[model samples]
Target: MCPSKVAEGGQRGWIVPIGGAEDKENDKRVLRRFLELCGGDGAEIAVIPTASRLNETGDRYEQIFGGMGARNVHVLDFDTRRDAHERNRVARIEQASGIFITGGNQLRLSTILGGTPVAQAIRACNAHGIPVGGTSAGAGILSEHMIAGGDSETETPRANGVRLAPGLGLTNRVVIDQHFRQRDRLGRLLAALAYNPFAIGLGVDEDTAAFIGPDNVVEVEGSGAVTVVDADGLQFSSMAQVDGDSPVCMLGVQLHILTAGASYNLVTRKASAGELSTVKE
Candidate 1:
């Protein structure tokens, strides 16, 4: 577990972004780690299953967190935008020490939670030192620019291969993609970076997570690795010169593969000493 510390601006929250397919039946390491960041057994957690279509999604997490010894676990479920705006429903988020977003369709999460009271409350919760965790589609929406959906095929980088949309914007200047190596989504993540070369693209593999502290320090966890694509120093790119469907050509796009226990500074765009290993082109 990462040692907790006071973040910049005096905030004490944590942003735990897990790739999809965490082990729920066995160790439950990811969820347990989230609980630890949220103050362990004394934490009040709110589980948001808005991204999932399954009816039992919320119940499953509620039971899991309860079993983990959370002081209180409330599942926030809403069908329509109006439901997201309900005062009573939004109040639950304000009182929680931690919030967990389940996996499903990321588009559904932005559509239902966007511009609503619940979304605003969540932002406020994170701002005031409350730990927030999400997996799969839940992890996808933790950025300012989210990958809504995209082609999973390993094709040449193209503009149309991936789609981008507004997310919860819990963190700006970053884009997150989940189920990375498990789904072979490197191509899609590359395509996304082609469109927005200035933003950092993170492709998190299954069972792995990027624990981002309030101070902008990210620590890798789980069995898999986190792929960091930094296109800010790109030497060349045909993204703007070519048509929408044309293949993109980018050079000098730095790539870093961060394994468990590795640390990266999001603000400096640099990895910790000896922890940084470049992915060869």
Candidate 2:
């Protein structure tokens, strides 16, 4: 549940990747910790099943909340334009203690829910100290600037390897990419940082998460690691010819890699030492 500062004082959120969920023991642990952050109260788990390909995703969501001791779980089916779906989603977000975006095509979620009334409601949750978390596509949409998806490991320097999509922007000046190590998405994340020095690029490995607290303190959790790319001080060549899919040469960038327990201040753009130390492994 983290400390009281995260649970009751300010905005806190978590980002996770798809197919990276831990076992029941770990899931229960995370849920407990997150609930504590929501003032030790049972969180209203809102599942956006919009991205899922099948109805079973809805069922899986029910199980998730049940395991977390959250009796209030709502699934929003964005595939339908029915007022009922939209109204229900809005109501759920307004009362939710936490929101979770399920794994699937993040682009689909954004396209369907981007400007909807429900989207605004979710933002309100962030404004309130309620922690919002996502796995896979859900994690991808937490940043103001989001990585829709891209080709990794090509090394072809092709443009459009990483597609930039409008995220929910619960947090500003950041872009998040998931399944980083499993997918080797450093290049794309770096490109994103190079393109926008004002933003920090976070690549979260599968089975891992970045738990960000109200003070803008970010902690790495799970078995994997978190990578932060800071290009704010780097000098880069022009991206004029890069277009959308072309890769541009990005040199002199600084990257900080941190494992679990390490923390970084997203606001100051500085990696912390001691309890928040950055380490290779």
Candidate 3:
């Protein structure tokens, strides 16, 4: 895993593929990792399940996180933001040492928090190394160029994924997508990279996560894996043909699959470049 240079005393973050509730084992492990990143007990943590299966999402989080040893887990119901609701949510983000986002429809998170006080608060918390993390949808929004949300089964370049209006640009020049293999999203990610070649593409698998540090190191953990598609140095054809909802032939692109015990360097935007556990593609 590509573990960043740990600060003397700072919180770390884990980007999971959809929050850890679905997988009991993964949830436990992620919770342990969160605890570790928070430096163990007394870590002020909050869980925002803003992205969930619509109805019954918030209460589900209390049940899951409460069982994970999180004593004071604050749930932010962004669906209907009252004045006091916004203030409390922003306050929690500002004071939080660790903020965890739940998995569901990322669009839900973006629509509510986009250009809002809470979005800024979330970004501020991440900037200070407060360890902002999420699974599935949460993981997808970490990149400056977020995938937002997209459709599947359509491999054409015409497929357009929503942008995070005002995403927390922790990692810039990159767009992230989750449920990679399980969902067959490589073509879509490639389409996104084709449209913006300068940006990187990361397709994370279920039950897997990428632990990133301030130093730009990303380590792969859990039973699943992460795919890194770097088109920055690729030799490709015109994106116009593909933009017409047609398939475009991509000539050269660097793709790497980083699984458990593997790591990647975000600064270099390459995998297996450091001493961390990693594999060359």
Query: Model 2: per-residue lDDT, tens digit, 1-281?
Result: 01222334455454333324543455554445555555443656777777778888867866767666676777767785443246655887788777777778888778777767777777766766667777778888777788877778753334566678788777775678887888788878876666667878787877777787766778777777788887777787446567776667876676788876777788898886545434457
Residue-level lDDT of model 3, residues 129-172, one tens digit each, is 77777777887766666776555555444434323333556666
Q: What is candidate 3's local distance difference test score?
A: 0.66
| Candidate 3 segments exceeding 4 Å error | 1-22, 25-27, 53-55, 81-85, 154-166, 273-281
RMSD of each: 4.8, 4.8, 4.9
lDDT of 1 by residue, 58-177 (tens): 999988988888999999998899999898889999999999999998888999998788888877788788988899999998878889887785646776778889888788767899
Better of 1 and 2 by TM-score: 1
Question: What TM-score does candidate 3 reach?
Answer: 0.82
TM-score of each model, paired residue for residue: 0.91, 0.84, 0.82
Count of clashing residue pairs in every prediction:
0, 14, 8
Of 1 and 3, the candidate ranking higher by lDDT: 1
Which of 2 and 3 is ahead in lDDT?
A: 2
